[model samples]
Structure formats: C-alpha cells, structure tokens
Target: MLSIAMSTLRERWVAFVVSLVALALGVGIIATIALVMNSALTGFPGQRAALTGTVVLLSVSAGVTGFATVFIVASTFALTVIQRTRELALFRLIGATPQQVRRMIVIEALLLAAIGCVAGVVISLVGAPVLASVLASSGLAPSWFEVSISPVPLVLVCLGGMGLTALSVSVASRRAATIRPTQSLRESAGDPPGARPGRSARTGWGVALLLISLMGMGVVAAVLPELATVPVVYLWVLLTLVAAVALLAPALVLPVLRLLTLPWARGGSAIGTLVRENTLTMARRTAATTLPILITAGMSISLLGALETIGHAQSVEAGERLRADYVLVPEGGPAISAEALDRARKIPGVRIAPLAPTTVQVTGEAGLADGFWGYATDAQRFAAMTSLPLIDGTLEDFGPGGIVVSDIWELGAGQRVTVTPDGGKPVQLTVAAVVGDSAGGGDFYLDVSDTGPRPAEAAYVQAGGEAAAALRERSGELGASLLTKAEWAATVGNSDQGTGVIGMLVTLGIAIVYSCIAIVNTMVMAATARRRDLTLLRLLGATSRQAVAALLAESVVIAAAAMVLATAASAINFAGLLAALTQVVPGATLAVPWAPVLAFAATSALLAILATTLTATAAVRTPAPLSE
Candidate 1:
C-alpha cells in the first residue's frame, strides 16, 4: 500500500503541490497561534492579564483556518482522484479489493500530511518572532513578551494536522472505492460522488444542524447567561453553518447557475452562453472553487462586522456619558497637580471637578478582584460637573469615606467594602451610590481627599458664558490639554480602533490568502482540463478571443455564485454573533462595515478574472490539435 501510494503521488505531483502548500500554510498558522498562547500563559500572570478576549480571538481564527484547510485539502485531493478514475478502475479490474483502494488513498493522505506538518513546523519557527512583534505593536501583548518555543504544541499540532488530513480524504477514498471495473473502457471520467447521499439528506442536515445550534444558543441565553460570554459559542455556530453550506453546495450549484444565466442565455453573446453551460456541467469543479470563497468571505465579513459593532457601541456610550463641556488631562504624562486645578478654577465663572484615578484591590461579598479602575473625586463638585445615572442612592451621599460602584457590582449603596489602594492601607468604606453600568469608567469611586495627595489624572470643568473662552486660553498654562466632549470621545474611539483593526486583520488575513490560492489553482486546473474542448471550439470557427471571453465569463459566474452563498452564510454567522453579544454585553448595536466587505468581494472577483484569464489564454495558445 505504501509503495503504491508513493507511485501514485509521483505520477500526480503537479496536482498535489498546491494542496501540500496550502495545508502546510494553514497548519503553520494554527501552530503559531498555539505557541503564542503558550508564551502568554507562561509569561503573563493572572488569567485576565494572560488571555481572556485574546484567547477567544485566536481560537476563532485557528478554527476558521483549520476548517478552510480541510475543505481546500479535500477538494484538491478529490479533484486529483477524479483525474485518475480510469487508472483506479483498471486496478479494480485486476482484482484489487475496495478496502485496499481505500487504504491506498488514506496512506497517500497520511504521507502528504507528514510532509506538510513538518514543513509547517519549520515555517512556524521562523514566524514566531514576527507574530510576537505584531502582537506587541497592536498592544495585544506586553513589551517584555517573547515567543517561547516548546515541543508540546508542535507535536500536538502535527497530530492534529494529520488527523484532519486523514478525515478529509474519507470522501475521496469512498469515491475511489466505488469505481466500477468497467469504467476503464469509458472515454471520460464519471461524476465524482455528490456532497451527500441525496438532496433531501443534504437539505435535512443543513436545517437540522442550524436549528440545533440555534436551540443550543437559546438555552445558553436562558439558563447560563454568562456562558454566552465565551467566544466558543460564536466559533461553533459559525463553523456549523459553514459545514452545512459545504454539504449543500454541490446540489444547489446547477439550479443557481441556471437561474442566474437566464438573461445571458436569452440575448448575450454565444461565448457567454457557452461559459454558463460549461460551469453548470462541472458541478464538483464549481463546488471546489466556491467552497473556499464562501469560507473566506463569510469569516471576513462576519468578524469585521462584530468587532466594529462593539467598538461603535463603546464609543457611543463614552460620548453619552460625559456631562462636562471640556475635559483636561496630561497626554501620557504625570497627573495634574493641585496648583493646576486651582489655576483652572481661578478662571471666571468656572467650577472644576478633580478626579484622582487609581486601581484598587476590592474584597467584597463577590470575593477578591484586583486592578479595578477607581477614581476619587469630590462628590459635590463631581455632581455639579457631571451626571451619574444612579441605580441606588444619590450623589449627595458621595462625600469623604464614600464610594460609588457600577451596576455590575453585586454590592450596592450602604454596603461596607474593603478597598486597598496600591501602596496604601486597606480602608473600609460605605458605598454611597451605585450607578448604571454605562457610567463609562471604573466601578469604584472614592472621596478625593481619602485617596491621599495623588495628583489628579483627569478633571471635568463646567464654564458659563464668558468663562468658557477664558478657560480655553489658560488651559495650557494649567499644564493640561483641554478637549471638548466630542474630541474626548474621538480620543477614546481612536484607542479602540487600533485594537479592533488589529483583530480584524489577523482573523481575516488567513482566510483571504487561502481563498486566493484556491481560486488560482482551481481556475488553472479547470482551464487545463477542458483544453481539448476549447481546441475543438476553435477548430469549429470560434476565435481565440471568444474562447478566452467564455472562460472569463465562466469565472465570473462561479465567483458570483460563491459571493451569494457566502453572503447568506455570513448573515447567519453575524446573526449568531449579535445574539451572543446581546446576552453577554447588552447595548451593543449591530454595525456592518460595508466598505471592507465590498472591498473583499471586489478583490475576490478581480482575482478570479486574472487567474482564469491568464490560464485560459495560455491553454488556448496551442499550435495545433492532437488526437486524444
């Protein structure tokens, strides 16, 4: 079996090369993520500091990459098997058992996986520093971070890659086993197996899986609301929907193509009609081409939409939470001093609200939580300059020795809590006010005087008519930059924007790369496979230009079908994400980044055109026809 598999791979190395490269790259990405996670765990202390949201992001990305790798590897290998239909049929005629044939294919996959996994590990070794640098630059990792190389993650990833590759070949192996002994005498290869047993089974599975996932989510929302905060929920739902579409893709392609080709069939040029018919006849080819597109576009749009929506929500909340006309703060410098606060307040008709910011370790009824962003401010002045939407108690009680908590806290006003400021003695304080979660900052607020002589990190000033202009001029003299409410909101938005963009790029970048490789390989092979037909068309009076145009049109039609299907799958993914976010983090609105989505679609189309056109043009440049 090993010898036979090696011989077969030697014979078909051209077709196997792309599958090998793609699998290696995909596996490399997954291994890199694992290494990064391991490094963070060993280097960073505490669960929150090490990985929380970042872990979720990396896991989702790895899941998408793994899914795509399976799809592309399986499709490419299946295509290779189809090309050897007659050869396999001859082996069957020679009395090779179906089991032997299946073993042969599986062995081939294992061997390929071994090679790919080794290559992937080597690539990951080179890529680790680059990955760490990127994470550091994006503020996702600390400056002291360095990649930790360990054999554990590499071995695990290698085994995982091998397992995925073997599983992916099941469909291809089954197809090979089912080849009849008589097929060796046929002129061309028969159709590869359908995506599933039948249309009804495929449709049934798609609906059943979708419903089951939705039901599971509904249960999570109702019974365990906190579980909705887990990113796995989003990843599972997205991959489940993607799998259903993959099952249904082959069955649905022809009908969709027919429906879309009606206008072209009626009045378009002969080349257009020919292109449409050619794509329709090749269902497996079309499915292989479209699957990667669906995954790439679906993942890209869904993730970008989710991140942008969350960022927009945060920005909006920040803007609405501010009540002061202008906020003054040093730009990454030392805190503002009492002299600066005095100078600002000396301006005519101005009332200054000073806030000393510090993080504290809280020991309360809910247990110990550290690094809570707490600010100390004068209650009366704070109340005069800003509004706190209270869930309980009033700002009038927010004086010396008093504290305010956000709605997320279990402790309310009148509860005794121990707050330990960094380098300070733990003090017992009474919570005077419990504000709504949208209060937009640290949960704990203490009296300014009790927070000691720590300089003020921020201050909000309310100025009347003439005092507003006077305040703006003396802002620099007070050693702080003055920003209007809108400007302050913009500053906050910019910070979130950096994080969001980084996340978006890392998640979507892998998918797009896979999509490009799949498109180019499928288009080149498709064109090459139909070379005889193209030559015959030219012999029958069709011009080379027309032939190329037909191929171009065919590429467009396949890309269009892929985009439509991908959009549908993405809608499902986005809906699932929105549902989870609503339960976990309330008040987040759905924000679709139309520009990025459109750009992704346009790039897919352009790649398809360029790939198909170049391949078709080269294939049709033959000097003369040869007898098959």
Candidate 2:
C-alpha cells in the first residue's frame, strides 16, 4: 500500500501539489497563532488585562484559519478522489478490496500531510517573529513582546494537521471505495451518475445548520444584544451559514448556473450551451469550485459589513445624542488644562461639561477584581450637554458620592457598589442612574469630587448667538481644537472602528489566501480531468481556440454563480446582524462593503478563468489516441 501510494503521488504530483501547499500554509498559520497565544498566556505575568486582548485576537485568527484549512483540504481531497475514479476502478478489477482502496487513499493523504506539516513548522520559525512584531506595532501586544517557541505547540499542530487530513480524506475515500469497477469505467466515458444517496444527507444537514444559525441570531438579538457587535459571534453565525451553503452547493449550484446562463442558452450561443451542459453534468465539480468563493467572498462581506454597519450606527447614535454646539479637544496633549476650561467657561452664554477619564477596580461576585473604565464630570452639566438615555433613576440624583453606570452593570437605582479608584481607597457609592450603552461612553461615571483632581479629557459645549464664535476663538488661543458635532461624530466613527476593522482584516487574511489557492487548485484539477472531453471536442471538429473559449466561459459561469450565491448568503447574515443592532442602536442602517466584496469577487473570477484557460489550452494542444 505504501509503495502504491508513493507511486501514485509521483504520477499525479501536479494534482496533489496544490493540496500540499494549501495544507502547509494552513498549518503554518495555525502553528504561528498557537505560539503567539501561548506566549501571551505565559509571558505576560500580572498583566492579564493587557494580554487578554492579544489572546482573543490570536484565538479568533486560529478559528478562522482552522476552518479554512479543513474546508479547503476536504474539498481538494474529494476532487482528487473523483478525478481518480477510473484508476480506483482498475485497482478493484485487479482484486483490490474496498478496504484496501480506502487504506491506500488514507495513506496517500497521511504522506502528503506529514511533509506539509514539517514544511509548515519550518515556515513558522521564520514567520513567528515577524508576526509578533506586527502585533506589537499594532498595539495589540506589548512593545516588549517576543515569540516564545516551544516544541510542544509545534508537535501538537503537526499531529492535529495529520488528524484533520485523515478525517477529510476518509470521507472522500468512502465514496471512492464504493465505486463499482464497471460503473466507474462507463461513467468515465461521459455518462455520469444522476444523483448520489449522499445528496439528501447533505441537503438535510444544510437545512439543519441554517436553522440553527437563524436561532442563534434570534437569541443574540432578543437576549444578548450586547454580543451583536462582537466579531466572534458574527463569525460563528457567518461560518454556519457558509457551511450550510457549501453542503447544499451541489443541489443549488446547477439551478443558479442555469438561471444565469438562461439568456445565453436561449440566444443559441454554442459556448453558452456548452457551459450550461458542462456545469449541469459536472455539478459536483462546479460546487467544489464554487465553495471557496462562497466562503471567501461571503465571509468577508458579511463580517466587514457588520462591522461597518455597527460603526455607522454608533456614530449616528452618538451624533443624535449630543446636544453640543462644539466639542473641545486638547491640541497637543492628552487632556485639556484647567486654565483652558476656565477660558472656555468665560465665553458668554457657553455651557461646558468637562469629562475626565478614570478607571475603577470592581470586586465581582467571584471576588475577582475587574477594571471598569469611567469618566468624572458634573452630572448636571453633562446631562445638559448630552441626551443620555436613562434606563433607571435620574441624572439629577447623580451628586456627591453617587455613580452613574452603563446598563452593562447589574446595579440599578440606589444600589451601593464598591469601587477602588486608581490611586485611592475603596469606597462605596450609590448607583444614581443607569444609562443605555453608547459608543465612546465609558462603563460608568463618577462625581467630579469623588475622582480627585484630573484634567478634563474633552468637553462638550453649548453656545448660542455669538458665544459659539467667541468660544471657537478662545479655544484656539488655549491651544485646543474645536470641532462641530458632525465632525466629532465622523471622527468618532472613523477612529473607534479602526482597531476592530484591523483585527477583522487580520483574521480574514488567511481565509482569503486559502480561498485563492483552493480556487486555483480546484479549477486546475477540474481542467486536467476534462482533457478527454477537450480531446473529444477537437475530434468533433471544434477548434482548440473554440474549446478553450468554452472552458473559460464555463469558468466564468461558475465564478458568477458562486458570487451570486455568496451575495445572497451575506444578505441573510446582514439582516440578522441588523436585527440585533436595532435593539442596541435605534434606526441602525446597513453599510455594505461594496468595494472589498466586489474586488474579491473579481479577483477570484479572474483566477478561475486563467487557471481553466491555461490548463485546458495545454490539454487541447496534446494529441491523444481515442479511448477504446
């Protein structure tokens, strides 16, 4: 079996090379993430809060990379098995048992996986430091952070990669092993089977997963609205939908292709007819090619769209809540000075609410100390400057020793909570009011007197008549920047979402690269298998140019179908996210990432066309004897 597997790999190395590269890249990404995460956990002693964000980022990266790896590996393995149907049939004809065939397939996959894993580990040794530097520069990690290589993480990732490969190949092997010797040979001659028994199971699982995702969306919208903006939650839902679509691709791709090609088919174009017929007859291959596009384009659009929408909603909400005429920010320092605040206050008919940022350590029910960021301000002036929605109690009650908390806290009106300031003794303060969550709003608010003497971070001002111009002039003299409410909102919208968007892009980077590799791999493999069909076309008097044109057209149809299906899936995902956002930010609107999604689709389609055209053109140029 080992010798046979080695011989087969050498004979079909072109077909296997893509899988090997993809697996190696996947394993490398996973290993790198593991190393970074492990270092974050062990190296950042006594700085759990600082390292928590890094750990979360690494974990999300691992999840995204793992899913893409498994998905691409499985699809490629399945395609490989399909392409080798005739070869497998010959083995059965030569007295090879089904078990033996299955074992051979598994052995082949293990061999490929072993080499891929080793190469991946070596790549990680060079990549880990670079990745660590990136994270540190991005402020996701500490400036002193360094990658700590351990043998344990490397070994575990290699084993996990092999295990995943075996599992993926085993499923594909089962179908290959069941191929009857005579039937496979006949099918190889162009009379493919209509439908497999597994189609029903795939459809069933697809429907079940979609239903589960819908329920999850509902739970988040109705019960845990706070999670609506969480990237991981959105990712979980997006992945479920992507999987459901992938499972149902075989059943769904044909209809979409037919619909897309209907005008061309009816127009009596030969290339169109061929494209339609080919996709219909080769539904599995079309589905396999489409899966990568769906995963990449769909996931990218949905996740990025959700983030954009959330940011837009927060900005709009913040703008609507602010009753300020101008926002005063420090020009060259972190906080506004007291003299600057006095100068602004001296302006005629100007009301200023200064906010001083602070943090408090809360002792949770588990006796664990947790940090909650808040601001110190005069509640009366703050309420006058911003219309903060109150869930309970009143801002009028927020005075000396009283604390205003965001709805995230469990405390309600009149509840006493212990909070220790950064450099002060722990003290009990009454919860005066609970406000709804808003972008840029801290977790809680304290009376100016309770928070000691701290410079104001920013101030919201209400100026009427000539007071606005007077305040603006004074602000410049005080070395402060004055921004209108709209400008402030735009700045908030752009700045607050930067880290989230960067993190999301980092996570999707792996998926996008894997998807590109998978798309090209699947297309080349499909084109190689169609050499016989291309030859038959040449025998039937079709020119090489014509045959290659037909193949390219078919690739275009497949790419278009994948994009259309991805757009639909992303729309569903956006709807669920928007539904959840409505509870948190009223009148929230969708913000589709048109540029990135369209660009991704175009790139993938171009890759498919190139891969098919080049491979099929070469196949058409080769003259071969007609099969008996």
TM-scores, all models, native as reference? 0.80, 0.89
RMSD of each: 4.9, 3.4
lDDT of 1 by residue, 1-628 (tens): 9999999889878767767877788788889887877676665675444355466556656777787777777777777677667788889999999999989989988888899999999988987778878876766665566788988989999999999998888887877888878878776433533433225444576668767766765765565544433334445655677667766777766777887787888987687678676666666667767766666666666666655664555566667667888778764444788777877777778887777877788775568575687787766778766666688988888878888887666777898888887668888888888975441466677876666756787788787768878877877777788778888766653343122456646766766776667767766766666677778778889899887887788888888888878777778766666565565446656788899888988887788789888878888997335443
Q: Tell me model 1's lDDT, rounded to 2 decimals.
A: 0.72
**Candidate 2 regions with alpha-carbon error over 4 angstroms:** 1-3, 44-51, 136-148, 187-191, 197-200, 328-361, 364-380, 421-424, 437-440, 448-481, 496-499, 623-628
**lDDT by residue for model 2 (192-250), tens:** 56654236555787889989988988988888766776665567877788777777777
**C-alpha displacement of 483 in model 2, angstroms?**
2.3
Clashing pairs in 1: none
Worst 10 residues of 2 by lDDT: 492-501
Error of 2 at 40 (Å): 3.6
